[model samples]
Target: AQSVTQPDIHITVSEGASLELRCNYSYGATPYLFWYVQSPGQGLQLLLKYFSGDTLVQGIKGFEAEFKRSQSSFNLRKPSVHWSDAAEYFCAVKLVRGSTLGRLYFGRGTQLTVWP
Candidate 1:
């Protein structure tokens, strides 16, 4: 069916190191995909999204994602990760049932730990 998968449960990185979080989705149609980050004891923050055109989408907090339709993936990337970037990252996709109303289906998040 339609779902999102984050293969890595947790990842550790050094401060100023590059980071990449894998995201995969299965959908029949052109999917509305999003990446979000949640800091500890805080609400989720929208990172980036992909609907159509220009596979590469820029997002806040120096984050970006490339949507690969051929591979059915939207992998998140950061050139360099800061210690403050330590948080839980989630991959999500919108699904519409019946009418135009849509709901989000999220993948199990990837926890990033940044060490000095």
Candidate 2:
């Protein structure tokens, strides 16, 4: 079964600090990776994704992610943290092929707190 794992359940960072949210997936083959942010009482917003092409993909809001096949990891990073960036981050995977093609699997989610 394919699944995504976010090691940190909650993270607290001071404003202007660097941020890194870890994401790891378990699948037989490489799967499409996605990072989504959900604000309080809001729907999920796409932050970034990694399907193919470059190993490092830039996303909205100064966010970026690197896909490492050898590590089975697609970790999200930002040089600086903002209070507005505080939200629940979820790591997801989508199957491009096989019987469950296009099926999306999500991680438990990581809650972020930014202190000013």
The numbered model that scores best in lDDT is 2
Worst 10 residues of 2 by lDDT: 95-104
Residue by residue across 1-116, what tens digits does model 1's lDDT show?
A: 66789999999999999999999988887678899999999999999988778999999999999998888899999999999999999999886634468988999999999999
Best by TM-score: 2
Candidate 2's C-alpha runs over 4 A off are 97-101
Record all residue pairs in model 1 with backbone atoms less than 3 Å apart, i.e. clashing: none
TM-score of 2: 0.94
What lDDT does the true structure give each of the candidates?
0.92, 0.94
